[model samples]
Target: MADPKGFMTTPREEWPRRPVEERVRDWDEVYVPGALLPIISKQADRCMDCGIPFCHDVCPLGNLIPEWNDLVAREDWRAAADRLHATNNFPEFTGRLCPAPCEAGCVLAINQPAVTIKNVECAIADRAWEEGFTPPRPPDRLSGRTVAVIGSGPTGLAAAQQLTRAGHTVAVYERDDRVGGLLRYGIPSFKMEKRHLERRLEQMRAEGTRFRTSTRVGRDVAADELRTRYDAVVIATGATAWRELPVPGRELAGIHQAMEYLPLSNRVGEGDLVVSPLCAAGKHVVIVGGGDTGADCLGTAVRDGAASVTQLDIYAQPGADRDEDAEPWPTYPKIYRLSAAHEEARDLVTAPAADADARLFAASTLRFTGDGSGHVRSLHLVEVDAGRRPLPGTGRTLPADLVLLALGFSGPDRTDGLVDQLGLAMHARGTIARDAGFATNVPGVFAAGDAARGQSLIVWAIAEGRAVAAAVDRYLTGSSRLPAPISAYDRPMAV
Candidate 1:
């Protein structure tokens, strides 16, 4: 431990964000640049470095948190980065995007605030780049085996990198014009800038991991054809079949899915468009579903100059502190937390009838009302009980010109015929059915990430990616040395 009494003395501190007034005006990352490095070492010192670190156990990537935390506290940037990379392929992405379940499982979190493991990880990754610690580690020799990975998302990217370094020829196919699937279009720039993704892509390219953009597997190239070309196929295509609202006036104009609204804004940031065609400027935006996607939409609308933005969450507001009996320590608890987007909305007073953080808890959409032009004008809603049954006398309406449905995804999109053509078995929940080793019903085809696990965290996606690569490597050769952090059935600690 860096300091014997570090956990006792140190109060937790996180990276400060840019002012809401200033950050909302631009598409750059919300965090103040160069802010984390200064205070990250001190924060890492707060780790107890437990005899049995539950933080490591809780992380899907099984990131060596205490080891890296110690190195970070010592200011050993190179070693910290190395430890971070041992279990995770994209620390930059995870450090920025992951919700940090590890923090929840931190021993200190049983009472005091958890260690700033995410900040330490991000600092080490960023500093590694500045100090030229990260480089393309191409395989010493090729195995003469070929693998084709579908999708260029976090899962696919992680799988591709691992396979490439394991001496296999890997080709990652992306349907979009760019390499990153959601990271490119679905995720907003305010959360994480594209430069971090670009640099990682460049490193992957240098390592001989090929990326084929603008190529749909089932349309441009047949899925069967890909299986024939490659020795093995790994399906890391994320679950993108978004759930529907199915309420009256859902077909009204100005009503769109979160994916549809978010991608256009991302395109504007990518220089593909001067302004988003579906821009929410001067419109009353009502986002249904209180998840990360909804929060993302909320932030994006604020940046686009929405007149008002209200987020409707189906679940009631959770308590400020953990419910010890219901959700004990070392497990993620349902608690009220304000995201950056919520803070922006609160500071700007965007949601008129919402809570302090701009969320209407336990609100269920009744129906949408449209104007004479068939454009959505207002949304009718009602407060619901724990069972989602509407509570009488709680009916209300909010002005909603632009309504975004952030209800989340169901399964991998089958519109491209990838699942049908491959004859992959699917779970009842609409996820790809995989064996304990991440293998699909199809002989040489494997599935992982959201496709196999349904909608999940970035850490889980990366863990699945790493595990699937090891399975593929073992299937090709007799045995393998790759680390498989989680099995196909391994699930996160959930209530």
Candidate 2:
């Protein structure tokens, strides 16, 4: 245990966000630089080191939480980093992007606040990089097997790193101009800078993971040819087919998909463009969705100097505290939360003190109205009850020059002809279907990540990647020693 009485003595604390006024002026990350390190040890000491740590089970990666917590509390940062990397290939990404289900499963959360596990993980990863503790570890000998992995997101990257370290020749192919899929473009720079991603890629390259960017399977290279060339193929293509807002005036000039708008802004950050073609400057922007994508749009719009930003959520506002009867302990619960982007939007001049909530919960978009010139002008909406039935006399309109649909994705896009050429079966929900071992219908072809599990968190993506790698290893050799964190059909604790 960390400090025998640490849980009772220390209070929970988190990384402080940069001031809204200062942060909104730049696209830098929202955190105050170097703020987490000083207090992270104390926060990590709060872990109880329970007899049965639910946090471990809740995490898809099955990270050694208590061990790392104890090491961090003892100021053994190098050992903490080793423990963190033992299960997770990219703690940096999960620390920045994951919603932290482990915290929800924390035993301490039964009464007091949970330990800052995510912050502690992020601190260790950053310190490891600063001290040059993160280095390439190439395989000792080649296994004489070749593997092809499509998509360079977290899943593909994790799998590639694992296979490379395990003595296999791995090649990751990405359709994008750069290696990273959403990590390079889907995510805005303000949330997580591109530099963090670049450094990791450098390490992967040194570890003998070949990256072939600007190459599209089933397009530039035939999918059948890839299968013939490699001993096995793993599909890590994420769920990118976005859901549509089927409403009137759908062809309005200013209305764009969240992926389309976000990528262009991210391109500007990558220095590929001086300005985004879908710039939100001086426009009234309306985002349809209350999830992280919408929050991302909110932050991007604010940085682009939008005149006003409004986010609409179809579901009712969640309560501040967990509903014990509805959602018991050891499960993730729906609770009202504020992101860094929401805080910046709250400080907007357009958001009044009385009703500063940028998110309008239980509000449904009826339709969009466009100007005579075909540009979006206003959005029609109405309040709805729990059943999603529109309430009477609740219809209203808000000015909207640019509208972004952050309604989330459907499944892996088959337009590339990869699924058609490979004859892979898809689940009823539209994701690629796989057996318990993460194998597709076709032999020697496997699926993992969002392509197989539907849109999910980065933690699950990494877990699926690691598990699928183990399965592929076993398929090649009679037996395998690689760790499989979770099965393909495994689900997270119900919320």
- Which one wins on lDDT? 1
Per-residue CA lDDT of model 2 for 1-495, tens digit only, reads 868899999999999999999999898999999999999999999998999999999998999999999999999989999999999999988889889999999999999898899999999999999988799999999999999999999999998888888888999999999988999999888889889999999999999999999988988999999999999999999999999999998889999999999999998988899999999999999999989999999999999999889999898889989899888888999898888988888777543421336888898999999989999999999999999999999998989999999999989988889999999999889999999999999999999999989999999999998999999998888677888999999999885
Candidate 2 worst ten-residue window by lDDT: 348-357
Badly placed stretches (over 4 Å) of model 2 are: 349-356
Lowest lDDT sum, 10 consecutive residues, model 1, at: 349-358
In the range 407-492, model 1's lDDT, one tens digit per residue, is 99999999999999999999999999999999999989999999889999999999999999999999999798999999999998
Off by over 4 Å in 1: none
| lDDT against the true structure, each candidate | 0.93, 0.91
* Candidate 2, residue 423: lDDT: 93
RMSD of each: 0.8, 1.2
Per-residue error for 367 in candidate 2, Å, reads 0.6
